[model samples]
Every structure is written in structure tokens, then in C-alpha cells.
Target: MPHSLLAVPPSRGGVVPALLAEGREVTGSHLRELAARLAPPMDAVAAYHFGWIDQHGDPSAGDAGKAVRPALALLSARAAGAAAEVAAPGAVAVELVHNFSLLHDDLMDGDTTRRHRPTAWTVHGPSQAILTGDALLTLAVDVLTRVPEPEIARRATARLSSATRGLIDGQAQDLSFEARVSVGVEECLAMEGRKTGDLLGCSAAIGAVLAGADEPTADRLHTFGHDLGLAFQAVDDLLGIWGAEERTGKPRWSDLRRRKKSLPVAAALERDCPAARRLADLYAEPEPPEGETEDRLAHLAELVEEAGGRSWTEDKARALYRSALGALDGVDMPFGVREEFTAFAAFVIGRDN
Candidate 1:
């Protein structure tokens, strides 16, 4: 397959560039300010995680993540006919919660690197990482509760709390899935909806709420974000299996090595094909192939593809991307703002990392 097959086409007329620039100029500054409010050591860890600093506590420019959630929040606000700045608090809150999950997820998964740098848990110790994650989660609430309008603040806080709870429950499910021998594609999709979609949905909805959008508009944006999140997760699972170490900042075939029941693997396992049965037998082993781990993993990736896992996941991602775009039909936004939002949805599934 051509490399172009890997990503959704870039949005026409440079909408992605405008959205990314706005995201950095608007949301990035506020994210930094919020990180600075943490206590010294924790602040440094947060900065490092955000890619503003290196492991030795020195300044180093690194790629923070794509900033998709904050961008979604900002764009949703604009799509509701409000200035993007009106949703800054929503952006900050969602970004904080996102980093909180990253910090703890790295620890839980024993991941040593992210964004091409050492993970916080590895550099700061798991306990410190856990505390930093906790602090970030609390700060999300603090920032939202401090919004100038009491009623808006209350609503935003409630929405964020519900999303965070769903995220935690999803994480619990993910960990449990790792230990189980079988996980259905439907169950995995539902878990992904909670683990990934709920937060993105909340981010979009919170922005609309902050902008005082009508209930129907907010619900539509929420659905858009939710579908986009699922598409993003599907693509991420594909990358976890086949992405380059340099591009993904992790070991090759990391998901296979860990036996993660990600969407692709679950889809493959659910198949009635011969390759699916063989893949299941490999997974049932108490240990990975002792001497040929690399080759075994390579074969496993082939099995997943042969079992129709790859095509199923790719088709699902495309379908969800369409569903997400369709949700924007009646959003009542400016043409330019709507284009930016569409471009962002494309970027979410097309991102390399």
C-alpha cells in the first residue's frame, strides 16, 4: 500500500495549518501557565511531560502531543459563534485531564518513553508520577471552578468530573482486558468510547456550554468529538502494532509484545478464520517465543492482517470519521470555522503519533 493510504487526505486550502497555529497560540500558552502553578518538582515533571523540558531538567523543545482535545474545545467554542478565547478555561481543563491520564497511564503500562523522551514515571519515580497525575486531575477541577460565571463553572466542573470518572472506569477495563484471554470487539469499542471518546466529547460539549450554545448544538458537537475519538483510537491501535519506533516513540510491535487487546487485535481474535485461531494459540502461551521474539511478533502482525483485523479496523476508522464529520451538518458555525473543525477531525485520525 502507498504511504498516502496511511492518513486521511489533508484538508483543502490549509485549514489544518490555521487550526494548529490557533491551537498553539491560544491553548498552548494557557497550558503552560497552568503547569507553572504546580509545586517545584511536580511542576518540572509536568513541564517535562508536556515536552517543554528534558529529563535533566534543562530546557529543550520537544513535541507536545498534537493538542487535539484542546483544539477541539477551542474550535467547538468558535463553532458556536463565540471567540475561541471564551473557551480557554475549557481548553485548559481538558488538557490538564489529558496529561493526568498520560502520566498515570505511562506508569500503569510500564511505558518508558513518550513524545520521544523519558516518561515521567521513569524519570521521577512512579510515586511522584502518580502524585503529579493526581495534582493535574485536581487542577482541572480547580481551573474550571474558578471560571468567572458561577453557573458556567458549575456545569463545566460537573461535565469534566463525569468524563474523568468514565476515563478511570475505562482504564480499569483496559487493565482487566490485558489479563483476560478473550475480549469481544463490541466490548473493546465500548471501552474505547469511555476511555477515549468520553473525554473528547466532554471537551467539545464544555466549550459549547461555556459559549452558551443551545442544547441541540452542544449535543451534536459532543457526538462529533465522540466519533472522532473512536476513530483516533482505532488508528492509534494500528500504529501501536505497525508504526516505526522513531515515529511512535516506542518499541516496534509494542502492543503485540504486551499482548494488549487493542481494537485491531480484538477484531482479529473475534474472527472465525484459521489465522485467528493460530493467533489465539500464540496469545495463550505463558511467554512469548523465547528466542525469536522479534520474528514471532512480526508473524503475529501478519496473522492479525490475515485474519482481517487490519481491514476491519481501517474500515471502522473511516466509517467513524465520516460519522464525526456528519455530526457537524447543522452546527451553525462560520464557513471558515467549520473548515478548521473538519480539518482537525482529519488530523485526529491521520496523526503519526
Candidate 2:
């Protein structure tokens, strides 16, 4: 019952992260309050985007995306010894910024659906969606600044601003990769960090800053978030190529069609296999007619698997997750909270959509 897709993913096996329910409850309340404060059409647009209201302003249970990032933020605060109530603003700010990125990204990527629902840009038109995204980003900062303590507010804002800048640069790198003839695995990995990891790193550590946590604690938490984000993106890349359109709310083979040079593709290209060469050939050709695309993409997917792209990416994801959880060693926190984190990390890597 929230908007925005996952930094983690949808809960499964009934293993919801600790404080996730509280995170959703509080973040949802704040989001609704913030949406009400926006101007007339923008408020309506924002509400529609969040699945709180339909295109005609009626309520719907349509795909609202999982509220994983906000939950993670609140968990970070709880781990750092702050009450969930006290750190709610930090959680909400992280949610807003993430959604802002989604709004722009959906439009720029020309994605038509997410979570089995029409993307905001498609329903409301691209211009309105862009403006709404801009509004959400601004709102995130405003929410942070409203925190009662001036120093905490400043620290939170600065950390978030730095992350946003890195995210933008990552976006640039991502787009540039699409136009290039070749890309390296290491470079794509670095780009993935900037685009996906930086904000998540901020989300993980921001609550610590808000709670007046020391530098060492915040830094380790940042690493926790950053590595987790990379693991999340690996799953996303797999979904982009192989996910069911109905389950993922994305067009099938969208990434391969775009020849976007995702991790799998980059790694596969490095292989010395026949499929690798053919996959490269396919990537260079312009997309065929819509009717012909499915089989072509299917073959392309097979080739990627044959070249061992899929398996490598999966192994890398699990490895990144291990590194992420390893960052928590010696971090002072509740044992229960630490247990919840381990379960949550497992859940993130295990989620199918």
C-alpha cells in the first residue's frame, strides 16, 4: 500500500522486515499530508501516481510499489538508537527522493508500466510527470529541513544532496552506455553504484545522521546501503531482460531491445563464446518490427544465458549481499534488529519481482 518501487523488493514468504509496517504506516501518513499540501492539479497527480487515487480521483489498490527504502531508513534509525517516530522525517525524505527519481526515470526510459500499472508519465502525460517528480524532490528537502534540530537537519540535507548529485551523474553514465559500441564490466559496475547505490547508501545512513550517530557508525551504514543497492540493481537488470511483463509491470525484453549494456550484457560480452559474438551482433542491429521482436529477443535471451551472463550476475548479486551484511560486524545495535536485517537482506536478494 505505498508508491515507488523497491530499493529492496516486495515482501515474500511472510518475512517482512522488522519496523516495515511501522515504516509504511508513518511514511504513508506523511506522504498523504504532503500530497494534500501540493497545488490542485499537482496534488491530484501526485495522489494518482501513488495509487491512493485513480485517474478519475477514486481510490484503488493498484500497484503502489513496495515501500522498502523507507522501511530500510527507519530500520537504520532504529539500529542507530533512535525511535522510529523521531526518525520518520528522514524515512519520508528518502522515500520522496526515490520516487522523484522514478518519475523522471520512467519518462526518460520510455517505460510504459511499472508493477502492472501504467506509469505516471503515460497516464498523465510526460510534462506533468516530470513536474510532479521535481515537486517530490523539492518536498524531500523541505521535509528534512523541518526536522526540529537545526544541526541534524543540515547534516541530513547535505548527505542527501550529495547522493542526488551522484545519482544524476550515474544517470548520465547509464544513458551514455546505450550509445556506445562497447562497455566494460567494471565501468558498468561503477555506474551502477552511482545510479542505484548512492541514494540507497544515503537512505541507510541518513537516519544515523538524524539520530546524531558518530562518523564511524554512519560510514559503515553507508557501505551497508551502497552494497545492498548494487545487489538490488542486479536483480533489476535480470528482470529487465527476463521478467514476466505481467509480474514485473515492464515490457518483456525491454533492456535487450534498448541494448542498454546492463551488467549481464557487459559480462557476457567479455566471454569467449559463440553466443557472445552473436549476442553482440544482435545488439548492433536495429530493432525489428514489433511483431518480430519477441522471437528475436527470446533468442537473444538464450544467447545471454548460453554465454553465462545470467549465472555470473546471479553469483555477483549473492556476493554483493554477503559484503553488505558483512559491514554490520561490530556495529552496536539491538540483536533483534540485527537479526531483522539479516532476514531482510536475504529477502531482498530472494524477491522475484
Candidate 3:
């Protein structure tokens, strides 16, 4: 197992259920093998990014993050009546693509830390971080090419390529929204659906495709992951505004500080309340050189909550969660597998970090 799956102090809060832990272990083995092929410092940088080694090259695994994408891949194959190994290639590819996005995202967003540690882009140069992300993305396709059947490889490659395009489009939209004076909740939802939902849908369906599942079953699995991805992003937006810095591994009011028009912020902006108007005014003001705006980020957060954004976001997440679970109902799977999927979905919206 990746040392990341080991129990840590409750203070550094996160949840990695046994299912996710198993998936992480399988993905880890493949990741290590791929990283070893890179030349010199690049290998070490990749290792460090995955929490398998520290900056100085000492062994570690305290912060590799939950492998939710890979776990979905594994379960998806099983749900289609295949063994976990049938999903291994897809699982690794999904995990690599996820980390690729994270590396680039941190660089683009000016985020300095992730998983309670300095981000790869901050420690290494921005150029290296970009290179690493590019390499990982290439490797994601390479992983699929290793599958025995040529047709399976071709189909999986198409799935990943399509998802990557969605992720890119979503990221671009997210950046564009930051420049806009106002953002609609619907637009934000669409962007998030592309950014987070596309890959998750791929993760849930790719394995089934590899396992020879029929089109309808794979479609249902895709729906399950896609809706869950939206719920995941909703919870993430809540954390960006209100989560504890210690547990969430991000600054308090992180989204407000970045002027992110995330779900809550966009919903608040759509409201008719005075708080929403003031929030809009605050957003319209020039961004300070240091970005604190006289430390009004807290006020921005308060304004969002008062405008009913938080409640609206929370309710939306619950609804999305229900929709995700409902998508699984049409698929044929053992009762226990269904329950496992349910628990995992619950954990997505409920996790503290």
C-alpha cells in the first residue's frame, strides 16, 4: 500500500475508506514504475508530487490524497462483473490525469500548497511543473496502450482524450469567470461539470469498457460518476469558503481571496438581497496588490452566507448526491456493491477535506 493510506492523526483530517485505499495501492505500483522511467530530477519530482518521497529523497507517503477516481474505476469494473485487475490500467490512467490537472491547476491558480505541503510548482520551477503535468498526461494515454486488446486500448484512449478536452474547457471557463463582474450559477455548474465531472465519468466507465461491458451499462456508470463529480465540486466550493484551514489544507476564505466565482459566490451574486449587492460591489473593486482588500475576505464570506448561498449550495449538493445514487439503480450489480458505492458517495459530500 502507499504509505499515504496509513492512519494519521485525526488533526490532519481526511477520510480514505478501505476501498479507496486498495485502489491507491494498485495505482501506486504503476505510478512508481512510470516515474522510474523519467530521467534524474524528473523522477524525484514525480515521486515527491505523489508523496512517495520528500524533497531530500527520503521515503514518505503522508499526503498522496485519496484516490477517489481510481477507486471508482475499480468498483466500476466489478459492478460490470470483472476482477479488479481488469481495471488496473484505467485506474492508473485516471489517477495520473487527476494529478496532472492538480499540478497545472495549482500553477495557474497561484496556489502554493496542497495536501498540507508545499505544492510541486512552488518547490520546483513553474516550467518543471508544467513539464511534469504534460508528461503525466502523455503517460495516461501510454497506460491504455499497454492493454492487450487493440480495440479496448483505442476506445479507452478516446474516452480519456474526450475527458481531457472537457477538463481543459472547464479550466478555461473557470479562469474567465474570475475576470467577469458577475457569474451565473448555471454557468458555474456547467464549467464544473466539465472540469471535474468529465474525468470522473471516464473513470467510472473506462474500466467497464475495458471489461467488455455493454453500452447502456457503461452509460449508467458514467452518469453515476458525473453527478457525483458535481456534488464533489459543490462540497469543494463550500470548503474553499468555510472549511477550517488546518483540515482543508488551504487558507480560510481561500476562494474569496482568489476572487473565485465558485458555486456559493455565484449563487450569492444571483440573490436579490443587500448582502449580494454589497458582495458584488466588493468584487468590482480593484484587487489589491497583496489581495487581502483590507482583510475583507471574511466579510465577503459572511455576505455569501447571509445571501443564502451556503444553504443553496448545501441543498444542491444533497440533490446531486441523490441523483448520482439514482443513476446506479438501473445498473445490475450485487446489493453489497451498491451499498459500497452509496457509502463512497456519502463520503464525497461529507468529508471535511
Candidate 4:
């Protein structure tokens, strides 16, 4: 079996950790400053959501996510021969958008925990969390509009807005998929491409836009990010089924519990094998799986794997990773930056959390 298909233990050291370390060092303070610019209540809510503060609004440090979007923005800028600082606003904008999505997603998905901490909706109430998400969405546009160069700001803002719209559409599709008994594998892939890929693609392109790179170069970078984002989502779907609860900060078999039509589940459903038929029967049960016992959820996960979902998703992820790297072919990027980007791609496939 491919390593990514197995229930491998989380990696302690890898490109993700290294990039996250550099990302925190480079963009951490800037992101906090931006978050602090919100109104008083919203600032506190945003701070807590960003893992910069405790529920009581006191200073506290937590996971704060992987900072992948910001890292991509900065790296894309550097790849375009511009200083990382030139893309700081773009990075901040992407981060705000990312957090905005997270806040809304937690509310929509009824998730109680994030990054091993109580989610914003759990701590601050749903209304406050919703308003804070709204604030973050607006703040993303505000950050882009304040960029010193008007043309660049305008381009970046449009790109971000378009991606945000796609993200919303994708979320809607995801919710709708749950109500249906059957969903096509292609449809699921497209939904994920938009839900996850759109933002990453925007993150990649915004840097080039800010740096005034040519259209072809910007398009190539967008393709790179889009493909990478699909691979990232595939890995995430795998983790949703098989990752350690401690590392993922979610219950074991959380995806199965929710009946989420993630890539693997969808692929398994599409198969005509006996295991797939059995899995379908389980999903067809009238009651939602939320109240299901761990044993039942474990069986559902096994059915998915027995139906070939795990290997299918793993192969798809690896293929997308290669396609992402291929998208960078002949693009003008610094050697060190290109090497780093390549390592990041590898890390996405092998990541445990």
C-alpha cells in the first residue's frame, strides 16, 4: 500500500514544520496586527479564532493553523523576483479569508473543536462567531484595498473576491451532497477543487499580481496552487478517516460520523464492489451517523477502505502532486524558492495533520 494510504503515525519533522516555522517568524506579527485592527469585540473574537488569545481574551499561544496560505503568497512573490515584504498585504488578506472560512465552516459543520481548542462558536456563541467571520471577510478586502499600489490592490481584491465566491459555492455543494444518497466522484473532486483550490490559487496569483508579473507566469502559478490544493484536500480526506484524533484535533472517524462525502467516501460509493454495496447500505440508514458508536464508525471506515477508497484517494493525491509540480515547469523562480516549493508539495502528500 502507498504510505499515504496507510494509517501511518504523524511525522514530527518535515517540510511542513520547517515552512510553518519560517512562516510564523515572517508573518506572525503582521497577521496579529491586522487582526487587532478589528473593532473591540470582533478583535477579541478574531484573536481567539486565530489562536493568539484564550477564550477570556487573555494572551495565549496555540496551534494557529499551518500558515500555508501566507507561506504560498510570500513564496510566490519571491518567485516573481519581488521581496517577500511586497506581498505581505496579500498574505495577510489570504489569511483573513482563510480564517473567515474556518469560522463559518465550524458553525455550519457544528464542529466544537479546532486546533485542539474550543471553536469560536463554542466559546463566543454562534451569533458572535458569525459576525466575527463577517468582519474577517470585510477585513480581507480592506487589507487588499490599502495596498500602496492602486492597480495591484484592485487586481488582488478582484482575485480574492472571485475565489471567495467559489469557496461559498463549493460549501453549498458540500452541504447539498449530504442530503443525497449518491454523488459522483467527478462532482466531489470539482467541489473540493473549488472549496480548497480556489483560495490557494488566489493566494498564488495574488503575489504575482502584487509583484507585477506577466499574465502567463501568474496563470502558471495559479495552476500550480490549484493542483496542489486538490492534493492537499485529498490528504485531508484521508486523515479525516484514519488520522489520530489527538493529531487531527477531531474525533476518530469524524468524517464518517458526519456522513461527509469526502473524496475517499465518494470514491468508495462509486465503486460497484460488494464492500461498496455494503457501505451504501450503511449510509442509507435513516438516522444520521452523528449518534453512532465508535465501533459503527470504525466499520464504516473499514468498508470504505475495503471498497478501495483509501488507495484511490492516495493515488489521486500523488498524481495531483506531480501535476502541481509540472505546472511550475519553465516558470522563472529562484532556485532556492523552487526547491522549497517542491519540498512543500512532497510534504502535502505525506502530512499527517
TM-score for each model: 0.95, 0.93, 0.93, 0.94
lDDT of 1 by residue, 220-338 (tens): 99899889889989988988998888889888888898889999899999999899999999988866345437888999999999998888998899889989999988788876877
In model 3, residue pairs whose N, Cα or C atoms come closer than 3 Å (at least 3 residues apart or on different chains), thus clashing, are none
> Which one wins on lDDT?
3
Note the clash tally of each candidate.
0, 0, 0, 0
For TM-score, the strongest prediction is 1
* Cα-based lDDT for every prediction: 0.86, 0.83, 0.86, 0.85
lDDT of 3: 0.86
Tens digits of per-residue lDDT for model 2 on 1-353? Answer: 11122344344445564456777787988899998898877787888888888888899877666777787888888788887676788889988888888889888888887767788898889989988989999999999999889998998999899888888899989989888878988999999999989988998888888888887998898898899999889888888788777667778888887777999899899999999999899888877655446788789889988998888888888888889999999799965777777777777676667
Model 3: CA > 4 A from native: 1-16, 289-295
lDDT at 51, model 3: 92
Q: In model 3, how large is the Cα lDDT of residue 202?
A: 94
Which pairs of residues clash in candidate 1, taking residues 3 or more apart in a chain or in different chains? none
Q: Give the winner by TM-score: 1 or 3.
A: 1
Inter-residue clash pairs, candidate 2: none
C-alpha lDDT of candidate 2 relative to the true structure: 0.83
